[model samples]
Target: MAAYAGLAFLSFLWGSSFLLIKIASRAFDPFGFALARVGVAAAAMLMTSAVSGKVWPGSRPGLWVKLLALALIGQVIPFMLLAKAATLTTSAEMALMMGAQPIFVFVFGRFLGSSDRWTWLAALGLAIGFAGVGVAFWSPGAGGGAHAVLGRAFALAAGVFYGTGAIISGAATREIGAVRAVTASMTISTLVLGLIGLAFGRLPPPVTLLEIPLGPMLAMGALGVFNTALAYYVYFRLVHDEGPTFASLNNYIAPVIGVIAGAAALAEPVGPSAWVGLALVL
Candidate 1:
């Protein structure tokens, strides 16, 4: 029960992140925001891990490779994708697309030799959920435009990456423990994102902290502390306790929270179809 509650709260945290990212993106480009957010998250995790008496694992090439893969797929790639998508679509749309992550997790887990068998009930749920997505897309005033389609595609790609990440994190955490696994992954992600931002010439035309508004800076900090750092801790715990397929259920719950948050915080539109879709997803 405690695990379930933790997972639910984690979903809420992630749901609210869409709003934060939307606000923060006004100050930072996709690469820039991803770099800063993950960097802060890495620092926070390192500090917390030290305070918790969690020691880093000994260097192993294989372990480092796995950690790198987890960092790239889980944090770097998806976060950049979502950040860019936020500029083109409503938070509600991105959240709804992410809600489909469990289906992909189940599929990926099967390919990875997970013994969990798929039943008709799971299929029905997926069908219903996807049908909801289609309804949301079909609704008037729901779709943004060509850019919205592209944004939705990117969001779905992020969801696929997240599904893959969950499977990897489950295995990685088993070997290294959750804190170390997250710490290493976040560290690597921050480094990679920083390099990417530099390569894209983000630094030369840098937008300094003074230039950005206080609201966005605060949002970015909250995103690091609550959404990235604390959320990943809860996520690792859920994956360790319940398995990846179950932990991925947070994807299903988060969109409902996101729709509500988007409506309340950003005054983003929630059309009838979107509401119906959110209900089906829940």
Candidate 2:
């Protein structure tokens, strides 16, 4: 029951994240935003592990390499893509688009030969979900323009990356323990995103940050502490306790919260198709 409660709370945190990301993107660009998120998250996780007497996984070059790959696929790439997409699309739309992640997870599970078995019901769910997504995006005029199209594409691609990351995380977590796995992965992601920021010249000069809005700055910090760090802690426990598919069930809960939160807080419009898509996703 405690585990279930934890997972539910984690879902709520993640559901609220789409709106936060959209808010934060106003101040930080893609690479910089991702870098800051993982950097602070890594710091928090490492501190928690240390305080809790969790031993670090050290001196394993192979494990580090695997962690690097997980960080890239799960954290860096998806985080950057989603952050970029948030700037272009409404939070409600992005949340529903993200709700399609489980379908892709099942598809990838087949290729990975994980325990996921697709039945007729699963196929029906997939079909319904895809149809719903189509309806949601099938709007008239500027709402379905090139930028929105591209943003939705990015969101979907992030979902694929997230699916692949889940598989990798499952294997790594089973071996190294969830806390250590997340700490290592976040550390690697911070480094990778930092380098990417430098390459893109998006790493802001320190003095320039004074001009950024306080609201967005606070949003970014909350994103790191609540969304990235604390959420990953709960998620890794879920993966370890319930398996990847079960942990991924947060995909179902979060988008609903996201839609409601976005509409309430941001006055974002939710069309009939969006409701259809959300229902199918649920």
Candidate 3:
């Protein structure tokens, strides 16, 4: 019950993250924003890990390789992609399209996830969820090449990456506790984002520092410390306890809150398709 409750709350926090990224991306380049967010998350994790006496993954060579892969798929690539996509897309569209996640997790989680099969109800729920995704994407609002489409595509791509990472994290969590797994993943993502940002000339420009507002900074700090770190920690525990099938339900719950938040906070339109999608999913 504790784990379930924690996972539910985790979804609520994470639901708003896409909007925060949209705000942060305005201040930093895509990779730069990704780098900064994950960088802050990593630094926070490092400090917490030190205080908590969690294993430093570098302490074990064998685990290090496994940790590295977890970082790449779980954090490094998808996060940057998400930030880039959010920069282009509307939050409502992004939220609505995320209704597809349960399908992604169900399909992927069945064959690829540690769990070999899912309950029929889970499958049916995911079918409804995918319908929602279609409605959200095909609505008149999503048809034209609006920035929302790019964002949707990016979010979709992130979903695929996120699914693959879920499978891997599902497996990896067996050996390492959730906190350690997230700590290692955040560190890897931070480093990978940093390198990519530098390689692509996407690093935060010098003006970025001066331009970052205190409000956004506070928001980012909350995101890095609470939303990203704490959310993942709770998620890892849920995944470890309940299996990925149950753990990834957060995706399903997230879109509703996300769309509402995007619409209310960002003044973005919730299109016909998005409405259609949300209805089907719920």
Candidate 4:
């Protein structure tokens, strides 16, 4: 019962992230938005770890390197990609794209030494999933422009990265604890994103921070705290307690919540074909 409840809660956190990303994108560029999300999440996670008396991998440079790589693959790249995608696509479409993550997780797990057995049924599901993506991509009034198409592509790419990261993190969480692993990875992600922002001048200027609307600011706060930090803690716990394959099940629930939230909150239109595609993907 607790596991199921955790799954539902995690889905809500991640599902709502699309809407928050859409809101935050209005105030900051994609990279800047990504940086802020990670920065805030990292701070929160680190503080939690400290309060809980968790010890970090200070002596293990190799582990630090691994965490850094995980940060880039799982956090930084996907966050930026999804942020960019949010700029070009509806939050509903972006949420649907997340349905592809489990497919990638299944494929990547096979090659990455996961113990899960591959079956013909799983293979067929993968084929159907890709077909659903195609249906969504070519559906009428889907994106409405080439830029939106590109955004869909970016969203799909983010799913791939997320799958790869999940597989890696699953193994990492076994060595350390889930909270510890998440804390370390988020911290590394924050530093890497901050450096990238500095190098590329993507960070929002100090003065412009005051100019951001209250709605977007609140959205970012929710994103960083609930979506990134708290959601990830729950996710890693699922990965540790169940498995990555089981953890990816949240994708199914999250898209439904996201689509409904998008339509209700933002008045985003959801066409019949989009529903068909979402059903097929699920």
Candidate 5:
């Protein structure tokens, strides 16, 4: 129960993140924002690791493979992809896309998973959950947009990556503590993103000190450390105790809040299918 609660909380933090990011994107480009987000998160996690007396996870020579995968899929690549995808898509559509995470978890956890066996009911639950997402997004004017097919494809790809990240976390939990897993993931993610940014000619990141609003910066940083890093801490802890499936239930909650935030705060229009989809997903 503690684990489930933790995961749910993390989901809430992350779910509401889309609205925040959308607000922030006005001043910073998607790549720039994602770059900053991961870069800062990595640094924060390193500082946290040192203060908490935590060491990196895994001593085995082969463990780097999983760690690398986690950093790339969970943080670096998905961060960039999602940030870009969000800029092009509506929050309602993005929320619906995100609603697919739990099912992705089930797919990787049960059908493709090595450690756990899945129940048919679980499969049915996954289907119902995603079907709910479709219903929630189906509308007349804007039509719970699906990211222009290509953009939505990227979001789906991010979901797949996040799903695999959970599997990596599941594997890592056996060898490392929650703090260690999260810290290591963030640290490596930072480095990997830095390397990628450099390779793509973004070295030193152009360092244009934007005179952006303090509120947005604070919100972004808060989202980074609290939602991304700290949330992962909560998430990994849950995976260590309650199993990944239970821990992942938060995915549903997060996206719903994303849609609500976008609609209520941003005044973005939502179609009726979105509510139906939310009900089905819930």
Candidate 6:
């Protein structure tokens, strides 16, 4: 029961992340937004590790290299992509697009020499998932336009990066504990994104920050602390207790919440096609 409860909470945190992204993006550009999300998460995770006396991979160059790759693929790239998508698409649509992640995970796992054998049902699911993506893209929802189509593409691509990162994470998590792995990777992501933000002049000036609305600032704080940091902790705990298969159930449940939250809270349109596509994707 506790495990199930944790799963439910985890699903809510992840599912509503798209809406938070939409709200937070109003203040920060893609690079700045991604940096803030990962930076806050990194700080939280680092503090947790420190309190627990958990040490990171201190001298292992190879593990550091792998963590760097995970930071870029898992944290940096997908984060920026999703933030960019938030500008062009509705939160609900972005959530639905993420349904493709598991499909990509399965496909990438096969090529990565996973022992899992292929089956007809898996193939059917893949077909259905891709078809659903096509349907969703066929008619962009509220504020539909060429830019929205491009946003959907970015969201889909983010899923691909996420899937690839999940496959790669197995190695890192094995070497270091899940919490430590997340901390190291997110720390690396924070540094990398910080440098990029500085290079591109994406980071807002201090006075400009004062002019930003309170709602968006609060949205960013909630997004980073709850949706990103705490969510990762809950998700890893669920994976440890219930296994990956059960933990992955969030992929199904969260999108429903995303759609509902978008429509109810943000008044984002959810046409018949969006429902049909979401059904097929699930």
Q: After superposition, how far is residue 266 of candidate 3 from its true place, in Å?
A: 1.8
Alpha-carbon runs more than 4 Å astray in model 5: 111-114, 136-151, 204-207
Q: Which stretches of candidate 4 lie over 4 Å from their true place?
A: none
lDDT per residue as tens, model 2, 1-282? 977797799889999999899899988888778888898889988998999898988777877777888899989999999988887888877777777777777777778756655588866776677666666665431256788778877887888898888877877787788889989999989877778678878678889778889999899888998998899878878777776666776777788998999999998887776787778777
Q: Which pairs, if any, clash in model 1?
A: none
Model 4 agreement with the true structure over 1-282: per-residue lDDT tens digits: 888899899999999899999899998887888888998898898899999999886657777776877899999999999999998889988888888888888889989977566689877877687677667766664557788788888988999999988888887788888888989999888888778778877777789889999999999998998899999999999888878877877887788888999999998998787798888877
Q: What is candidate 4's TM-score against the reference?
A: 0.94
> What does candidate 5's lDDT look like per residue over 111-133, in tens digits?
54536556899889888987876
* Predictions in order: lDDT: 0.84, 0.81, 0.75, 0.85, 0.73, 0.81
Report the C-alpha lDDT of model 6 over 97-176, residue by residue, as the tens digit.
87777677777777764434557886687668667767877775777889888898999899888777766676677677
Off by over 4 Å in 2: 1-3, 116-123, 140-142
RMSD of each predicted structure: 1.8, 2.1, 2.2, 1.6, 2.4, 2.3
Ranking by TM-score: 4, 1, 2, 6, 3, 5
Candidate 4: lDDT of 149?
80
Question: In terms of lDDT, which candidate is strongest?
Answer: 4
What is the lDDT for 138 in model 2? 56
Task: List TM-scores for all candidates, in order.
Answer: 0.94, 0.92, 0.91, 0.94, 0.89, 0.91
Error of 3 at 129 (Å): 0.7
Model 1 agreement with the true structure over 87-126: per-residue lDDT tens digits: 8888888888887888888889988754455688987887
Candidate 4: residue 265 lDDT (0-100):
95
Worst 10 residues of 4 by lDDT: 134-143
With a 3 Å backbone cut-off (N, CA, C), the pairs that clash in candidate 4 are none
Q: Candidate 3 — what's its lDDT? A: 0.75
Please give the lDDT score for candidate 6. 0.81
